[model samples]
Target: MNRNQHIWLSVFFSLALGLLLWKLKLPNLFIYSLPMYPTAILPDFIEPALDPNHRKFFHSKRMFKFLVICLVILLLLASFKSQHYFFWFFGVLGYLLHLIAESLTFKGLPN
Candidate 1:
């Protein structure tokens, strides 16, 4: 898909995931409210970084993989701590969803 297509798809998927979470009545969903809204629109800002000539590493698949790993670690840590597992699971799921959305674009795949 093109950059614009990726952006719209990401927004749609993110919103759909958010609504699903909301309907599930998950606790601490409010904490994600701000991030979730911006997530739907983040592709606009992110597309520039995906430019092939850009030197920045933010648009790399390695970075997304690292982020996913980090989130999973956080989820694991949250599980061992006094925090709720559902919250951590949802957070990780959301992050993964974001990555998946990005993966639909050309820049999202690994080179």
Candidate 2:
């Protein structure tokens, strides 16, 4: 799918998640879901222009792991410094949506 498709799909997914998690602490996944629409295309620009494995780098498991680490680090740092939970949670959800959107293209993290 293209950028527009990814954006619409991510928006839909985020809507569902937001409703499902409405009672939870982070109910506003939709607020931060915008990041996924653009970030989902990062791999295409960063990877070789004509490379077949274009989505490998940004959508791969390593990238997901790195995002997890970043999230953890952010949470840990939040203990010491003031952090806006809304954006942080939105960013985390957006990152996951980026991965999920890629998977929809049948590019489920490099083998």
Candidate 3:
């Protein structure tokens, strides 16, 4: 339940949830709009910007909760507009699973 454990758990849970969602044939859950040609690995460039230690906003629980709320609202909006809701639901569920897994590890508490 240390930092390493937390990371591993989060990764495992996320991957498992992603696999499950993929099996369910959901769409738009994993889509990203990036330039066709990338100069570097996307995560490497993105992770530091999103890293908690770097004062990233989304790294906090409050921000995460806010995100969930926003996602739910978006999902409802999509449903109202007759758009697909499967991906939204699946994506939120997967993110929540990752958060929960991280919570179970020691890293859940503030340093």
Candidate 4:
């Protein structure tokens, strides 16, 4: 699918996640939905400036793994009476969802 389609899908995913969190009485309601859509597509915006190969570098398996580990660790570290945990948690969620969707595209994903 195209970028717009991917974006809408990501937004839908994010919103659903947010609603689930809200229903479960999780802290920071809609936090993931708010910034996740943009966060999910950020690589598409930055890839041109960062690399000619685009998604290959930014969306690489290694990068995704590292990002997930770092975000989860940071989220856990900041979870205790800290508001910043929301940013990290939502960012990670959005990024993961974006990559998962992108994997289905013709572009596929890097190693």
Candidate 5:
């Protein structure tokens, strides 16, 4: 997918997550969604979309799993009220959502 498509998907995902958090009475809703926009397009920034086959290491399944693990760790750290937990949480959440969007495309992310 293109950059614009990625951004829209990210926004949709963030909104859904925000709604869920709102229902759960989670605090700092703004902080949770703040970092998503930039981080959603971060893979492209890290590995530019020069061609159709540009989804390499940074956009791979391995990286997705790594970020999932990081997300879990951030959640754990949030219990301690870590000062920067939500920043990292939303950042990784955006990256994960990006990969999910890419994986839905015809040219899915690499293994």
Candidate 6:
């Protein structure tokens, strides 16, 4: 997807996530979820849309898995009550959403 599409999707998903966070009584709701937008477009920034096959290292399935692992690790660390938990969590979450959005395309994601 294009940058605009990624941004809109991030906005929608971020708002949804924000609502969930609010319902769960999480603190600093906006600060946590707002990172989603930039992160959602981060892959494109790292691997620009220079060609039809621009998705590579930063946009691969392996990268998604890496993010998932990082998310899990962050959650574990967050359990210790780290103040930066939501920021990093939502950042990775946003990037994962970008890969997911790309995976829906005809090209799909690389290994």
Model 4 lDDT per residue over 1-111, tens place: 456776898878876787788889974656534778777777677563244346767777887788779777867776766766777677777777777777777767789
- TM-score order, best first, reads 6, 5, 4, 2, 1, 3
Error of 1 at 92 (Å): 7.8
What TM-score would each prediction reach against the true structure?
0.54, 0.59, 0.43, 0.78, 0.88, 0.90
* Cα lDDT, model 5, residue 64: 94
For TM-score, candidate 1 versus 6, the one ahead is 6
lDDT of 1 by residue, 67-94 (tens): 6777777667666874554455544454
The residue pairs that clash in candidate 3, if any, are none
Mark the regions of model 6 whose C-alpha exceeds 4 Å error after superposition: none
Q: What are the per-residue Cα lDDT tens digits for candidate 3 across 11-58?
A: 565566556657878434434111111211222233343443432343
- The true-versus-predicted C-alpha distance at residue 65 of model 3, in Å, is 1.3
lDDT (C-alpha, whole model) for all candidates: 0.55, 0.62, 0.47, 0.72, 0.87, 0.87
Name every residue pair that clashes in candidate 1. none
In angstroms, give how far residue 93 of model 4 lies from its true place.
2.1
Which pairs clash in model 5? Answer: none
| Over 4 Å off, model 3 | 1-57, 109-111
- Which of candidates 1 and 2 reaches a greater TM-score? 2
Cα deviation at 8, candidate 3, in Å, is 9.5
RMSD of each: 4.4, 3.8, 7.0, 3.2, 1.6, 1.4
